[model samples]
Target: MASMDVSLKEMMAIDGAVGAVVVDYNSGMALGSLGGSKDLDLQIAAAGNTEVVKAKLRTMESLGLKDTIEDILITLNTQYHIIRPLTGRSGKGLFLYLALDRARGNLALARHNMRIIEEKLEV
Candidate 1:
């Protein structure tokens, strides 16, 4: 199993990856991060994304959907943002955020790899 540091590093290696962070959804704080440029404040992004996760959870509860969220994809004009909540026992309350250049990213492959990383991540 990979440690959190290793997982974040591996995420940064993905094609078109611009930023990556492991965040606490409950607190909206990044536990770890890498690859964000000055233009991208990953800390702020992490906090904002926490709200997104919370909103989805509230929606799911209201809908009576017992299923867990796999991931949330937000496609912007030039970028693709992926928010994946960690499901492992030790990873509860945490999530991973990945930003990719839309033109260069392979969304399917990225999602697949993120799942793998999440599975192996050692909280």
Candidate 2:
């Protein structure tokens, strides 16, 4: 399995990738982050995304849906944000967030790669 650093590095290698981070939704704190700056602040993004994850989790509970979120995708005018909660029991409460250039990214492939990355992440 890959370590957090390796995993984040691997994520950055994806085509069109701009930034990636592993965050804690409960505390809205990013434990690890790579890329994004100047106009894009990853810490702020991570905190905001914590709310997004919480809202989705709450909605799922209310609906009594037994499905877990594979990933949350937000399509913006110029970028696509992918939020993936680590499924490994050891990594519960943590999530992987990836930002990509919508015009340069292949959504399907990126999702697949993200899954692979999650599966291999050691933490």
Candidate 3:
């Protein structure tokens, strides 16, 4: 298993990664972060994405769907934002957030890597 810091560092190694963070959705707080800049404040992104996750969960409940979310992807002109909620017992309220430069990123590989990272993360 990998520590949070190591996992986050691995996330940054992805091609085109601009930032990565491990966030606690229940409190909208980031437990760890790497590679963010003035243009991309990971703390602010964590808070905003917490709302996104909450809303999706609520929507799923309201619709009576018993499915779990694999990941949430938001595409912009210049970037791709990926939110992956951790499913392990120790990681119940946490998620991994990754921002990538659109032109340089490989979405398929990034998603694949995120899944692997999630599986190995120690929380």
| Highest-scoring model, TM-score | 3
TM-score of 2: 0.97
Clash pairs, model 3 backbone: none
Question: Model 1: clashing residue pairs?
Answer: none
Which portions of model 1 miss their true places by more than 4 Å?
none
**Full ranking by TM-score:** 3, 1, 2
Instruction: Write the residue-wise lDDT of candidate 2 on 53-80 in tens digits.
Output: 9999999999999999999999999999
> What value of lDDT does candidate 1 attain over all alpha carbons?
0.95
Q: What is the C-alpha RMSD of each candidate to the true structure, in Å?
A: 0.6, 0.7, 0.5
CA shift of 83, model 2, Å: 0.3
Q: Put down candidate 1 lDDT per residue, 73-121, tens digits, no spaces.
A: 9999989999999999999999999999888889999999999999999
Clash counts for the predictions, in order: 0, 0, 0
Report, for every candidate in turn, its global Cα lDDT versus the true structure: 0.95, 0.94, 0.97
Better of 2 and 3 by lDDT: 3
Query: TM per model?
Result: 0.98, 0.97, 0.99
Query: For model 1, what is the error of residue 52's alpha carbon versus the real structure, in angstroms, after optimal superposition?
Result: 0.1
lDDT of 3 by residue, 1-123 (tens): 999999999999999999999999999999999999899999999999999999999999999999999999999999999999999999999999999999999999999999999999997
